[model samples]
Target: MAESTLGGGAQAASTSLKNPRTAAAVRLGLAWLIVGALVALAFSLHETPNRGAAASFSLLIGVALGVTFQRGRFCFFCIFRDFIENRDSSGLFAVLSALAVGGIGYAIVFGAFMPNPSGRGLPANAHIGPVSWVLVAGGLAFGVGMALSGACISGHLYRLGEGYTRAPLALFGSLVGFGVGFLTWHTLYVEAISVAPLAWLPKTLGYGGSLALHLALLSLIAALLLRHLPELPAQAGGKLTWRRIYQAVFVTRWNPLVTGALVGLIGTFAYLRVSPLGVTSQLSSLTRTALNNAGWLGDRLVGLDGFAGCAARVVDTITNNGILIGGLVAGSLAMALFTNRFQLSRLTVRGALTALLGGALMGWGAMVSLGCTVGTLLSGISAFALSGWLFGAAVFAGVWLGIKLRLHA
Candidate 1:
C-alpha cells in the first residue's frame, strides 16, 4: 500500500510538472497583472477627486486580507459551525491563533499610542463599545444570518470573488438591513448603548499586564485545542519537496494555522497603517448615502458621526472603506484565477432567498453592535475590549442555535 501510494504521488507530481512552461507563464502573467493593477489603482487614487495615499494604502491592505481569507478559508461562521456540528476544532484553532497574534500586535500598538495604558485616556479609535443588550441581540442576529446566507460579510466578499451566487443576494440584503438599522438607530443608541459600560482590559491591567494575561489565556486555550487536532490516517511515504512546497503554498490549501497568523498580521498592519479590519463599514456608508440621497434618512440620524463605532456618513466620493472592499474582491478574483479556482455559481430560489434574509440579519446586527465578526469580535478582542468577548460568545450561541434548528441540515 505504501509503495503504491508513493508511486501514485510521484505520477501526479510528474503530470503537474509536464506542463511546467505553460504553468509558469500563466503564473507569471497573473502576478504581473496583479502588480500592474495595484499600481494603476494607486496612481488613480492620487489623481482622483479624493486624492490621498491613504485610500491606496487601504486598498493594499484589503488585497492582502482578501488573499489570506480566500487562501485560508477563514470564515468565522464556518469555523464555529464546523466545531459545533462535527467537533472539528482546526478552524476554531485558526481563529484563536489569529486572535492571539492580533492581541499581541494590538498591545504593542496601543502601548506606543498611549504610554500610560492605565491612564484615563484611552487608545484612539479602538472599537471598544458599550456591552449592551443590543450587542447580544445584534450578535445573535448576525450569527443566524451567517448560517442562512452560508457565510459572514467577509465570507461573502471573498466567496463572491469565487463566483458564489448567494454572496450578491446576501450582500444586497445586508444593505437593506442597514437601512432598517438606520431607522431604529436613534432609539437603540439612546435607550440601550448610551448607558452601557465600556470595558477595556488595558484600562484595568495596563498594557504589559493585559498582554501577559491575554497571552497566558490564549496559550492555555491553544494547548487544550491541540489535543483535538485531527490525525489523518497514516499514509505511505509522502516526501516534501520544492515542487510540493509551491503547490502547498499557492495551488493547494494553506494550513489554517499559517492562514490565521497571516490574518492576524494583516489585521495588525491594517490598524497601524489605515483602520481596523472591517467589511460592513463600506456597506453601511453606501446605505446611508443612498437613503440620504433619497431623502429618507434625514440629518436627525446624523448624530452617529460622533460615536466611536463604524458610524455612517454620507458622501459622494469613494471612501477608504470602499477601496478596501473593492481591493478584497479584486485580490480574491486574481488569486482564484491564478489558482484555477474561479467558477461561476448558480443558486436555487431557496438558496437565493436564504442568502438575502441572512444578509439583512447581518446588517441589522452589525448596525446595532457597531461591527461584524471581523470588526467587532476579532478586532475587539485584539484590542482588549470586553465587548469583543461578549459579542463573540453571543455569536457562537447564535450559530449553535442556528445549527440546532437545522439551518444547514
Candidate 2:
C-alpha cells in the first residue's frame, strides 16, 4: 500500500508540471521568490557595516517609486501625450496632486529645518535652479525629446525594466548628449546661466504664503483641466472577496489621486531622510566619468559643481542615486513579471534611431537645465522655485509644437 501511494504521488506531481495553469503558477511563484530575495538583499545591505542604512533606504524608496510609476503609468510624457491627443486630463490630475501634496509636505519639513522663510538662506539640496533662456531652451528640447522617444528620462528608466527594446539605445544616446552638454557648458554658463536669477518663493512670500499660492495655482489648473477629464465608465458592483481584492490591487492600474499622494509622501520622506528625489545624478556622473577618463572632456566644467539641481560629479564609488536606480529597475522588473507584462518588444532601425536622437536631446536638455522633468519640474515646483514653473511652461509648449508637427509619429 505504501509503494502504491508513493507511485501515485509521483504521477500526480508529473501531471501537474505538464498542466499549463500549473506551469504558469510555478512561474509566478518563482517571480515572487526572486522579489523576496531582492527584499532580503536590501535588508542585508542595510545591516552591512560599510554600506550603511542610507543605501538600503534609497534602494527601498526606489523600489516603491518603481512600483508606483509602473502601477500608475506615471510617465510624464505619457501623461502629456494623453492630454494632447486624446483630450484626457485624468492623468494630469496626478501631476497636480503630487505637486500639491509634495508642496505641503515640503512646507512642513522646511518649517522644521528653517523656521524663518524670510531669510536669505535656502533649504539645503532643494531643486532651486536659475531662471534663464537656457533653462527654457532646455525644457523645450527635453519636451521634444520626450515626444520623439515616447518617454522621458525617468520613463525610459522604468520602461527599461518593462522589456522595452529601445530603452538601451535611448540611454546610450543620453550619455552622448551629456558629453555634448559638457562640451558646451563653459560657453552657455558664461553667456546666460551666470546671470540667471535663482528665484525662491519662500524668500519673498514666506512658507505660508508660498504654500497658499502654490495650492491656489494648482487648484486653478485643476479647474481648467476638469473640462478635459473624460468620465470613466462605472463598474458593476460585485461581492467582495480576498481574490477580488488581490486582483484589484495587483492587476488593475491604480487611481491617479492615490498614486499621486503616495508619490508625494515618498518624495517628502526621501527629502527628509536621503535627498531630493532626482534620477539624473548617477547617469550624468557616469557620462562625466567616462568622458574624463577618455581625456575627451575638459578638466573643469564652469560653474557646474555649484548648481543646486542634480549634481553630476566624477565619482569613484556607488552613491545613493546609483542604489536607488538599481532598486527602481529591479522593482519594476519584479512588478512587470508578476503582472505578466514583461514581453520583449520588436526593435526596428527607425525606432532605434529615433530613441537615440530623442534621448540625446533629453540628456543635453537635462544637463543644461540642471535637471529633467522629474528633477527640474516636479521636485523644483515642490520646492517652490519659479524656475520649475518656467521650465514646465516651456516643456508644455515644446510638447505642443512636437505634437503639431507629428514628431512623435
Candidate 3:
C-alpha cells in the first residue's frame, strides 16, 4: 500500500511538470531560490577575510540597482530615444527626479564631510572633472555609441541579464575602445586635460547657492519637458490586496517618479557607504590590465589616475565595482525570470556589427571621459560638477545626431 502511494505521488509530480502553469511556478520558484542564494552569498562574503563587509554591501547595492534599472527602464539611451522618437518626456522626468534627489542628498552628505564649501580642496572621490573640449568630444562619442548599440553601458549591463544577445558584443567592443583610449591617453592629457579647469559649483557659489541652482535648473528642465509629455492614462481605482500589490511591485513597470526617487536614494546610500554610483571602473580596469599585460599599454597613463570619476587600476581580485556588477547581473536575471521576461533572441550579422561599432565608440568615449552616463553625468551632476553638465549636453547633442542619421536603425 505504501509503495503504491509513493508511486502515485511520483506520477502526480511528473504530470505537474508537464503542465504549463506548473512549469511557470517551478521557474518562479527557481528564481526565488537563486535570489536567496545571492543574499546568502552576500552574508558569507561579509564574514570572509578577503572580500569583507564592503564587498557584501556593494553586492547588495548592486542587486538593488539592477532590480531598479530593470523595473524602472532607467536606461539613459532609452529615455532619450523615447523623447526623440515618440515625444514622450516621461522618462526624462525620471532622470531629472534622480538628479534632484541625488543632488539634495549629496548636499547634506557634503556638508557633513566638508564644513566649508568654498575651499581649495575638492570633496574626496567626487566625479568633478576638468571642463574642456576633450570632455565634450568624449560625451558626444558616448552618446552616439548609445544610439548605435541601443543602450548605454549601464543599460547594457542590466539588459545582459534579460538575455540581450548583443550585450556581449557591445561589451567586447567597449574593451577594444578602452584599449584604443589607453593608447591615445598621453596625447589628449598633455594637450588639453592638464590645463582644463575643474569647475565645482560649491567652490564658487557655496552649498546653499549650488543646491538652489541645481534645483532650479532641474525644475526648468522639467517645465520645458512638460510640453512633450503625453497625457497619462487615468489609473483604475480598486481595493488594494496582496495580489494587487504583487502585480504593482513585480508585474508592472514602475512609475517614473517612484523609480527615480528610489534610484536617488540608492545613489545616496552608495556614496555614503562604498563609493559614488558609477559602473565602468571595473570594465576599464580589466581593459587596462589586459593591455598592460600584453605590453601594449605603458605602466603610467599620464595624468589619468589623478582625476576621479571612476578610476581604473590593475587588480588581482574582484573589486567593489566588480562585485556590484556581478550582483546587478544576477539581480536582473532573477527579476527577468520571475517576471517571465527572459528570452534568448537570434542575433543577425548586421545587428552584431552595429552593436560592436557602437560599443567601441562608447568604450572609447567612457575611457577618455573617465566615466559613462552613470559616472560622469548622473554622479557628476549630483556632485555639482560643471563637467557633468557639459558632458550631459554633449551626449544629448550626440544622441540627437545619431537619431537624425538613423544610426539606431
lDDT scores in order: 0.82, 0.85, 0.89
* lDDT by residue (tens digit), candidate 2, 21-82: 55556657766886897789788989988787888899998998888888788888889999
- Model 2, runs deviating above 4 Å: 1-19, 235-240
Q: Would you estimate the TM-scores of all the predictions?
A: 0.89, 0.93, 0.94
How many backbone clashes are present in model 1?
Answer: 0
What is the C-alpha local distance difference test score of candidate 2? 0.85
Best by lDDT: 3
Report the Cα lDDT for candidate 1. Answer: 0.82
Which candidate number would show the highest TM-score if scored against the true structure? 3
Deviation in angstroms for 193 in model 1?
Answer: 0.6
How many pairs collide in each candidate, listed in order? Answer: 0, 0, 0
Tens digit per residue, CA lDDT, model 3, 287-381: 99988899988789889889887767876678999999999888988888787777676798988998999999999999889899999999999
Candidate 1 ranges beyond 4 A from true positions: 1-35, 46-50, 232-242
> What would the TM-score be for candidate 2 when compared with the true structure?
0.93
Between prediction 2 and prediction 3, the one with superior TM-score is 3
